[model samples]
Target: MENKVNRNIPDEILASYDYQPFTSTDIEGMPVERVLPTFKATTGSNKLVDSLADLVNKTVRDGMTISFHHHFREGDYVFNKVMRIIIDNGYQNLTLAPSSLTNVMNDIVVEAIEKGVVTNITSSGMRGTLGDAVSHGALANPVIFRSHGNRARAIETGAIKIDVAFLGVPNADEMGNANGMDGDSAFGSLGYALMDAQYAQTVVLITDTLKPYPNTPASIKQTQVDYVVKVDAVGDPEKIGSGATRFTKDPKELKIAEMVNNVITHSPYFKDGFSFQTGTGGAALAVTRFLRQAMLDNQIKASFALGGITKPTVDLLEEGLIGRLMDVQDFDKGAAESMHKNRNQQEIDASWYADAANKGAMVDKLDVVILSALEIDTKFNVNVMSGSDGVIRGAIGGHQDAATAKLTIISAPLVRGRIATVVRDVTTVVTPGESIDVLVTEVGIAINPLRQDLLAALSNVPGVPVFTIDELQQMAEKKVGTPKPLEFTDRVVALIEYRDGTIMDVIREVKD
Candidate 1:
């Protein structure tokens, strides 16, 4: 049945998850409840364990839900090490929940799924071989993909209760107090892992570097922990940002980014002390470079920058352009290193970053946010989850959460080979059009009609050509010649949730 948003979600699918359709975007000051875990009182001295196998034996069981954080990204070692132990010990029917899965985790995840060790899965996103396996129906249960904020919300609401969480930090103490900012393999904030630590029945801290009894400035405190295990190495810090957050020199991307700067500089929100967030992509990085010159020329300084911190954003902070850098996850070594030296570069957890239930999130104060889209429609709906072929290739991440910004701009090329970025309807609606304020493409810019003030603000502004979203779609179709519609089966592969925990869209299995 199609709900108020005119998005067709199957009735059975809706009933399975007990989800309601997205109706409106008015979610201001909504009170949120939390799910607290009950821990058995233990006045024991040291929580140190022997090995990964020992920790697995102590905490994990058959048919239980276990989690890990992806702060280490492709460099993470804890997931594979723990899963190997679980598989070796003959654990079956367990759920593998993580902040997100990277390409490096594909083989282990596939092997675990094939061996019946992991029967269920949930995360922000999955990619590479694991995504291909899931799309081809590898597991008995469908994967549940949520945005970072929604994942935090689900963990807090007890919708997805965790039995054990194997969190790896750069530094931790004997009692399991840990943070991601110190030691050799530092990956910055333990934002995504904080929810797991607070809620998981059993919390295990695996670290390469172990400090003394008390690890001060602990992001994951000793109170929330149950055991600590030492490891030779947690991850490779250099590969923490593989396949994402790279500088781009492509002419098309540069052009799109140049237009994005024009939209921001001409908009009403681009002034002194303005706050903003930019997504990770070649185009977004290029926008930072262009926007830096604009800020220098206009003599405007931003109040702060939010979300996943990158080197370019950190460079702005070091240059005294942005006052503060609220980091939830570090994208590169520069970002991780900056957190160690700079006081203004603060580390924040996922809840404080974008959790809808929190008193206030950093995204709420955002004046402008530039995001990338896999596909966007005339309604201004965005899809960062799947591709034109209906395969899950991306994560919701903080796309929906950051769309609450005053000026939300999606920067993308008009066409990628034969794929049209702008279309009549997106493959999936990850972020609703109601919250989106602008769509910035290489050819032109489309301002949401609801924001008449923005349209008027940039209407006569030089170098910014404002057009209707429909016109942008038509322009894309003309370039791509209206590519054939993707084929999909009725089998639901994944469920896309809005930031408020409602079912906005569902991904069907791709046709064989």
Candidate 2:
């Protein structure tokens, strides 16, 4: 059946899950009351555990749902180490629930699914071999894909109840008080894990460094933690940021960034005390640099910068161009290290960052946000979850959540290699068109007709040509002729959830 976005959802899958397909309404299945997990009041000064095996054996059982956080990104070690223990114990019908999955987890996740240890899965996205395996119907159940805020909301409302949560931190005390801003393996705010720690029935903290009693400014408090374990290494901080924080040198990317800057600087939101967020990618990161110069020239100072913290964004914060940095997750070691030194760089939980039910998420207050897209349609719908080959390779991350900003700008090249970034219709509509305002490519800028006010505001952005989204789509199709459609089987492999806990779309198994 076709949803409001015109994406087809299998009727059988919808009936089985009792899910409502995506529509224009913001909250399709909005939960009325917030759920608070029952916690045991125990008098324990120290909550230290000896090993991962002991931690898993004590907390895990058959058919239980377990959760984890991916703040470490690709450098994570706790996921594999703990999953191996759970698999060795021969746990069956266990549900794997993580904030998201990175390349480091692909092999162990595949092994567990093959071993029947993990029968169900839910996360932000899948990648590499694991995505391939899921695409071919390797697991017994379809994965439930959630945005970062959606996962937080799900856990809080018992929609995706987590029996056991294994969270890794950079440093922790013997009593389970922890923070991600300290020690050698520091990767930044424990934002995603904060929800897991608070709501999970059994919370486990895995750390590489054991600090003294009362680890100051604990992001993960002792009251929320059930146990703590020390390991050789939790993750590598350097690799977590890697290529994402680098400045772009390519002319196409620079042109896109420049176009985005022109759109922002000329728009109504570029005044003093404006707030913004720069989503990940070379072009998105480069927007911070261009925006910085524009802010300087206009004598503007932003009230705060929100979303994933990065080096370029931190530079602005340090230079006093932005007043506050609401750090939900840090993308680079520089931003992670900055958290230790900068008082203005505040650590926030996922719920506080983007949960729609929270009423006051940072995204709601955002003035401008620069995001990237794998594919976009004339309607301004975005597809960042899948590729032209119909394979899952990207995460929803904060794409849907951050799109709630006053002015949401998508920065991307017209095409990538042979795949057209702008398509007739997105393979998946992760973020609907209403939230997106402008599309800035190297070729030109397109303001959604839905926002005639913005179109009028940005009518004559100097040196930046403007056109209709249809014109951009035609140019893209002109360069690379009409592409063949992707083939998919009847079986649904995953359910893509909107930030409000509604079914945005479904990913069926790719046809062989």
Candidate 3:
């Protein structure tokens, strides 16, 4: 637990680094500066492009970075379409940046890398074939993986200037006003894409439903868009919520969910008007279900629910149990459709959602956040980056961003079959232990020693067993036995950056 840098470093030395200012202006309410007139297109000419191929050949150039949002999740067809077009046109040396990469995006991206069409990549996470390829050194350059909030901060500060942003919308106007809340393929909030539209040099709106001029309640305004194109279908609604938004059927997952509920109900912040966030995993989603009944029993109504939007969250909003849904991304079709119909569901960009360097972030108002961990150590440090076998199987996601909440609860099982969830130390530190408040598992709940106030409040909660974090670790070890230590080489494969862009830790490539 040694300090990464000397705490006594002089202020002048710290100022020399590109340290982001903690203070930020309230830009959300302020009107944006007058639109620059240099790139304005004439009204008479057609801004709609005929095909993806022609669009890529014309707008794309060498050494430029392009981005895509993964609102479509597993069923997204737009990424493959755009990438195929780019590859066929002989483009080279382009950087591919996306909010995340699904299994469907792996094949085309791997081909693009081999063909030299894509030379760089930056994203929230990678999986399947593409993940394996990248880990094994498929590309010359190491991929850069960022948390959702950090990516937003990078885009806003010009650290990662985007040349083009190919956004897939379910509905749009002729002038490129778009949103995820309408049409047949509604996927909810376009929070991630909002950043691209605001900052990208060229923003293209690709959609299936074209409405009239000045589309009302546009998530992405027409003023920021440069071109519009209509396609047969932007994505499949059924696939939008696949895999990520499932309710739990397993007993272990349900038990974990129940424990998480116990922790929340006993916490001091579980009163009316409290705001919270949860992940998309089975257990995490179950916590929402359990919380619903608790809310009904207590007659408590939340002020807001934030993060990846799902059907259940939208349902709560519809029932008036939650006042608002502040979405940064949509995880399901129902949430997306709710955006079109519900005025309370607000679409916000990454910076407004959780950029620590921004003037103010929505996460600052969060009372509690329920997070998932791949593994947690006795010190309460979390590792959502590597797997039990030491493979890079997870993403940083919003773990660190939400850890800043007043009460951050990490709910996980003590053991997963033969692999222990609690260890002496984690494989990689994605979230510092100082930010974590409570660790809840099916076997027991462990409140961080730093949070003695929470310990006093929850000490007498019925049906919930509280144990020291060390006791939980011992229980896990007794059940599964200690795992063999991981062997890592000196070469730094990846650097985990905090929301403020400080190096929290580095990941080394596994020794073969």
Candidate 4:
């Protein structure tokens, strides 16, 4: 039994998550509802627990929400290990909320969902077999997808109250003071997990290394945590950034990156003490390299670089080109290692990183942000949450929150294989067109009409062709022709929430 309540969503997309749509400008703060927990009296001793089973028995119950973090990316092992324990103990109808779900956690999640050990999920996104299962309506509830910022807002607002948070840190003391920048399994920046620690009813710290009491510079402090458990290993450090963040020798990506650099250097925001954010993709990473040369040539320094940090961003910090590195999550081993030695590379939590409901966020101060897109429409709306086929294949991860920057630049190719990236309408609208200012491609750069200042600024820039988003769409269609429209079912599979927690869009089941 599915129902619809409209708020100006397209007819092709259905809202079946009991959703209420609002104007994109409806970003005012709202009241929160929470299921608060009471704490037992303690006598100021170690909060160490014997095993995960002991931790679960004491804190978990049926129909409760549990959470995990993805700082380790594909190398994460905590999700499988803990879910296996919960399943074996026969905990039913529980909700699994994590910062994001990766391919490594897919099979275990599938098992949990099938056995009635889990019934609901909310996360940044899911992929591979798990995505397929959810897209086909294998669960009782539609999976809720959110941006990195929205997840923080939900946790804080008690929209999704976490009963227990099983956090994996590289090192922790007996009293539960932990950080991701130490010991053998260090992955760097416990930014996302810090929110869980601060808000969850019971916080469990799982670690491979136990240091002495009072670990200094703790990203997760003893005051916020409840128990500490030791594990054989938390994750594989080598796989932390195996493929996502890498240098590209591809000529096409380099051309797009160079064009982005030109747009930034000519923009009014590229001055001394300016701040920027760049993602961890081939072209987005290449933009950092190009910007570094420009910074040196112009003798300008940035105030800070923020978001899911990479090795190249760390390099800019080390060379004094960038003043500070505010890390919410680390993308590579080099970045993880940098947090240990660099005092200027500060660790921050997800809420402070991008929660739109908060008093303020770091993104509010961002001058320029370079992101990658799976698809973009002539209206400049971007989709990072699904493929051209309408399958749930991508994550909303900070795509909307960071777009609030003064200059939002999306780096993508004109065409991916036979698919045109610039379409008349996107398969999903994760980030509204009003927030986007420019799109950098190998062929040309498209400035959103909403951003006339950017148009005038980059009009005569040498070596970079400027075009309207409509022309870019025409250019892409010329090569690939109009693609066959993807077919979708009436059953809504997932709800995509904006950074402020409104139903901006929903994903429906794809027709076979």
lDDT per residue for candidate 3 within 1-512, as digits (tens), equals: 22342112223323543433222112244222223223555564346777877788888998899999988888898899899898888889998888788888999999998999988888877777787666656665656667888888778766667899999998888777777777887777788888888888899889988888777678898778888988888887778775346788988889889988988988889999999999888888899999999999999999999998788888889988999999888776667666777889888888788887667889889999999998998888888977776666777877788888999999998998898998988887778787899998888799999999999998888867899999999999989886779886655555566666655555566776
Alpha-carbon local distance difference test for all models: 0.87, 0.88, 0.80, 0.86
Query: Could you give candidate 4's per-residue lDDT for residues 1-512 as a string of tens digits?
Result: 12222224544443434455645643656654544445664667898888888788888999999999998789887878898899899999999899999999999889898999889999999888989888887877778898888998888878878989999988999998999988877888999998899888889999989998889778888988888999999888777665346678999999999999999999999999999999988888899999999999999999999998888898899999999998998888888888989999989888888988888889889999998899998878888988877778889888898999999999999999989999888888888887899999999899988888888999999998998889999999999988788887878778888887777777888888
TM-score of candidate 2 relative to the true fold: 0.97
Q: Name model 4 segments beyond 4 Å from true.
A: 1-18, 25-38, 243-246
Task: Give the winner by lDDT: 1 or 2.
Answer: 2
Top-TM-score structure, candidate number: 2
**Backbone clash count for every predicted candidate, in the order shown:** 0, 0, 3, 0
Ordering by TM-score:
2, 1, 4, 3
RMSD (CA, Å), each prediction: 1.6, 1.5, 4.5, 2.7
Query: Which RMSD does model 2 reach against the true structure?
Result: 1.5
Sliding window of 10 residues with minimal summed lDDT for model 4:
1-10
Kindly list the per-residue Cα lDDT of model 1 for residues 1-512, writing each as its tens digit: 88655778888878888888877767776667888888897778898887778778878889999999999998988888998899899899998889899888999999999999999898888877888888888877888888898888889988889999999989999898898889888888788899899999999999989898788778899999999899999998778764345668898888889989989998888999999999778999999999999999999999999999898999999899999999899888788877878999988888889988778888888899999899889999998888777778888899999998889999988788889999999998889999888888877899889999988888886667889999999998988796778888888888878888888888888887
* Candidate 2 stretches greater than 4 Å from native: 25-31
True lDDT of residue 280, candidate 2? 69
Model 3 — which ten-residue stretch has the worst lDDT? 1-10
